[model samples]
Target: LAPMLERTTSAVVNISTTGKVVVRDPFFNDPLFRRFFDVPRQRRERRISGLGSGVIFDADDGYIVTNSHVIDKAEDIVVTLENGQRFDATVIGKDPGADIAVIQVEADNLTEIPLGDSDDLRQGDFVVAIGNPFGLGQTVTSGIVSALGRSGLGIESYEDFIQTDASINPGNSGGALVNLRGELIGINTAIYGSGGNIGIGFAIPVNMAKQITAQLLEHGEVRRGRLGFVVQDLTPELAEAFGVAHKKGVVVARVEAKSPAQKAGVRVGDIIVSVNGREVENSAQVRNEIGLLRVGAQVQIEVLRNGKTRTLTASVGKQLKQTVSGKSLSDKLAGAKLSEAPEDPSRGTAAGIQVVKVEGRAASAGIRKGDIIISVNRKRVKTVSDMKAAIKKNPKTLLLNIQRQRQGLFILIR
Candidate 1:
């Protein structure tokens, strides 16, 4: 263990970041109160700093992999090697949905860790976690893989995690989880407890990280594609009813018109046994597999239809995120940018317009980014067209029903 640590620790680097965040006050934002008190109209900002860890996986190209959260909104990033050498780092790319980011530094004689196949990992496999916990510098902790294919933790948009009992804590994010052979198998990410290790930690499997890193390096963002089909988990009762021998699969609930799935002959009640030759057990796994694929990529989907196994080939389609300027729709909505909400297969297409940006009149009317406009003037609006029609019906008053995170509110613009 000591020999392996001696070789691998050099590849694990400490990451620190500095950025600024706006500090907003309701009283300061009020124009009437500001005028009455003669308060300055300038927004306030405060400097912020953060600490984390990273792995130098590509020494030749100087590419380092870390969690996106570690470098989110960072104005300046610094990487410190185990030998006390520091270098300024620049962002190559990031995927917030997957929580993986790649940074690069121009330096010489950097050691790179060997990549291991995380697909080969199993439950109870001996593994080691190396990171800078609590900004305490390099630290190594040993534990066995507690579980594999862990999901539904709501940690990330893609939730296939490698669960371990290793002692991962604050500042350990973006570190390396290695097998006994000193091969990198996972990226240390989240823990079960609140800002502390509670014998339950999760890491992004190396295979998934590798896939995301390749996309980020090539495109600077994860361009997720979709098959345009809805699916549900295959239950034992459904399997019995469908006369399928295996219950571990997903059932196609709906296939969108003119979609890739429909073109490939995917139908409702079809049991999706595998995607691109990899067997799937639930809807999330299917979603993850398809979401990681690039647009125009061909996929082989095997389905169990009417007790007969059939394979279909389909091309992945680019997910459409339509955006429109608020001024195009209504004058009261000026200075806001609206886009179609992300689609959720389980809930079909999302029925609202997401406020991607807000300023001026829209911001003054209490509109904000990330707020979903579910209705306008008491009429439901799902898309830009729907919103346009709703606003046209009632041009005098703009009544917006907004869904902000877990809360709902109403804002009027006149």
Candidate 2:
């Protein structure tokens, strides 16, 4: 282990970032008080700093991979090698939805870690996590893979995590999880406990990170594609009703008109078994499989329908952006421009309408820009049309379930 780590530790780098954040003050927000006191309206800014770890995956190109949150909003970034050499870094690209980022530094004689197949990993496999925990410089902790394909943690928009019992803590974000041979298998990202490790840590599988890194390097962003359908987990009751032998798949709930799935003959009541030859146990797996593919890529889908199995080939399509005026939906929602929220394939369904612009009655009702309308009058809405129909049914009273950042709130307008 010592010999292997000696060769591997050089590829793991310590990262530090500097940025600025606005300091909000209610006293400074009052127009009347500001006018009377003749005070300047410029907001206060505070310098901020963050620390984390990164892996030097492409040594020749000076490319490093790390967690997006580590470098998010950073104005300046610096990377320190194990030998005490430091180099300034620049962002190549970042995928916030997946919590993966690629940054580069111009340096010479760098060592790159060999990538391993995370799909080959299994429970109880010996693995080691290397990172700068709590800014204490490079540290290594050994553990076993506790679980695979872990999701629904709400940590990131897309989650197919590799769970381990390693000692991953603060400043370990974007570190490397390697096998016994020193091959990089995952990127350490999150912990299960409150600000500490509790024998449960999550890492982004290296396979998924590789896919995201390729897109970020080429396009500077990940352009996730969609299959043009919504699906729910296949319950035991539904599985029995559909004559399925096992309740391990997802049931097709809705298919968008003229979508690639529709064009490929996918329909409601179809039980999706797999995507591109990979078996999907749930909707999130299906979404993750399809979402990772590039737009226009051809995908083979297997479904069970009418107690028979069939395969369909479809092209992945780019997500559509549709917007509508608030007034068109309802008078109470006036002065707001709503659009379909960006699809999170990990969520396995369309989220809700986003308030892109808010003012007037919508603003007065406590709606703000960037707020997501999860439901209206207790009815779930995924698109502008859905919201319009929901508003029509409720007419007088408007009850909205909104997702504002990381919090959920309800607003009522009568």
Candidate 3:
């Protein structure tokens, strides 16, 4: 263990970040006093500090990998080495969905850790975790791989975690989880216990990190594949209804029109069995499989459709970043594709336009996909056309009655 520690400890780093956040006061916008009394227009600034850990994967190029949450909203980041040397770091790229981030520092005589195959990890294999726990200098703990491919934890959008019993605390985030050979197999990320290690910790697989880091290095952001489809876990009843042989699949709930999935003939109720030759047991697995692929990459999807297995090929599409130009109300609502709400007897579907893709003011106002706009300015809107007509009335502020996940909401868009 000493020899391996000597070989790998240099790659582990202690990360510290500082930033300023606006402290909002409740009286800043007091309408009663604003009419007569003079109010200060300035808001107070509060300094925030955070501590975490990181790994130096590329020593010569000075590329350091860490969790996205570590340096999120950080104005200044500094990475300290095992030898007490520190360097100012700059964020290269980050993927919040995956909780992975890459930062770079210009330094000399740094050490790089050897990357290992996370796919080769087996349960009960010995592993070591190195990080700065609770802001206490560098700490190391040993444990075995308790599980693999753990998901559905709601830790991130895409979760393919490697579970371990290593003592990973709050400050252990983004630290290195290495194999016995001193090869980095994972990045220590989260613990299931209350703010401390309870022998149940999760790590990001090194293979996934490698792919993300490569893309971040090249494009400054990961261009992940988007199939433009919504999926739900396949239940026994759904499997039987879809005539699927087994329940180990995801059922397509909705496919966006004009999307790659729709272009490839994918339809609702199709049971997705495999993606790119990899079997997916649930919607999360499907997302993890396709979300890691580069945009424009071709994926072969095998689905059980109408009791028959069919293969469809699709090229991943990129989400359009639409911006509004004109000042008209229609322009404010432009770039969003809407569809009529699907009928559901169980919930009694609402009469409204389901927001599929949103941009411009609609997105700026926090309108999200899947939100059903039931009324525009108190007038019932059963379709996109009705909503448009109501908006064309040119109200200074549009009050949207929205139904989100069966909950009603009122949002004002100006």
Candidate 4:
């Protein structure tokens, strides 16, 4: 254990961050009332600090990996090496949805930790965690791999966590989770043990971290393709309704007209079993798999429709940029361009017109620039003509079915 610690500890660094937080007085909201009552409207700013740990993966390049939440809203960051050498650091890239970040510092002769394949790990494997637990300096804890592929815990938008019984605490975020050979297999991220290590801690698999970090290094932000369809998990009831033997794949609820999925011949009621040859069990898995691929990349999608499994290839497209501007449309839409909705509807690609612009009454009513107006007054509208016909009825309250980013919701336009 001592020899293993000696080899890996040098690559682990302690991170400290500081920033300013602004606080406004409650009376600031009602200045007139405050003046009438002789109350002071004041604002205050205070300095906040944070501490965490990071691993030096590329010593020669001074590349380090850590948790995004550790440095979030931090104005100044400092990295301290095992030998007590401290240097200022800058953020290279970050994905908040994944809770992972890459930072760089100007240093020389740093020791780098060997990265191991997380997929090679199995249950009952011996693993060690090294981190600055609770800010009590560098600490080490031994544990076994309790589980793998833990997801849907609401920890992050993308979750493929490694569960362990390691002693991870508040300052342990972004620490190193290593195997018997002292190779990094995961990055310590979150703990479900309340305020301390209650024999349950989670880490982001090194495989996922490596992919996200590389993208961040190249683009400074992760860009994902929009499939132009909505899907739901294959529930047992849905399986019965779809006449399938078992609930094994995700069901395509709707496909955006003229979108990539439609162009690839994807349709409603298709049970998607795999993407790019990788089997997907749920909607989130499909999203994550497809999202990792770059725009314009062609992927093969396999689906079960009408009791037949077929594969279709699609060229991924970029997500529509969300801006409050676009070409003008008819008066009924209130100056917004009513076009085909781009992404998912809450109800999985409901028939609707996408609002490319938000002007006039629609803008005033909180109708965002990219909102997809799926229906009006319980009438489904797939195009500008359909919307016009629906508006001609002059319903007292226009109940609109809007799809934004594939989630369905009803918005009332009165």
Residue 387, candidate 1: C-alpha displacement in angstroms: 3.2
The lowest-lDDT stretch of 10 consecutive residues in candidate 4 is: 323-332
Q: Candidate 1 vs candidate 2: which has greater TM-score?
A: 1
* C-alpha lDDT values of all predictions: 0.90, 0.90, 0.84, 0.82
Clashes of each: 0, 0, 0, 4
Higher-scoring candidate on TM-score, 2 or 3: 2
Question: Which parts of model 4 are misplaced by more than 4 Å?
Answer: 27-41, 321-414
The order by descending TM-score is: 1, 2, 3, 4
Clash pairs for candidate 1: none
For model 2, where is the 10-residue window of minimal lDDT? 341-350
Q: Order the candidates by lDDT, highest first — what do you get?
A: 2, 1, 3, 4
Candidate 3 per-residue lDDT over residues 218-265, each given as its tens digit: 998888877878788888988777666686988898888899999999
- Candidate 3 Cα outliers beyond 4 Å, as residue runs: 30-36, 321-414
Task: Write model 2 residue lDDT over 1-414, tens digit each, in one string.
Answer: 999999899999999999997654557655578777977645567899999999999999999999999998899999999999999999999998789999999999999999999999999999999999999999999999999999867787678999999889999999999999999999999999677888999999999999999999999999999878888888899898887796688899888899999999999999999898988887778878888999999999999989889999999999776668999989999889998974443453348898867766677678987688999999999878888889889789999999875579999988
Measured by TM-score, the strongest candidate is: 1
> What clash pairs does model 3 have?
none
1-414 per-residue lDDT for model 1 (tens digits): 999998899999999999997656677767678767987655668899999999999999999999999999899999999999999999999998889999999999999999999999989999999999999999999999999988756577687899999899999999999999999999999999686999999999999999999999998999999888888889899898888888789999878899999998999999999999999988878988999999999999999998899999999998877779998999888889999874454323345898877876688788987688989999988888899899999898999998775468999887
Evaluate residue 328 in candidate 1 and report its C-alpha lDDT on the 0 to 100 scale.
Answer: 91
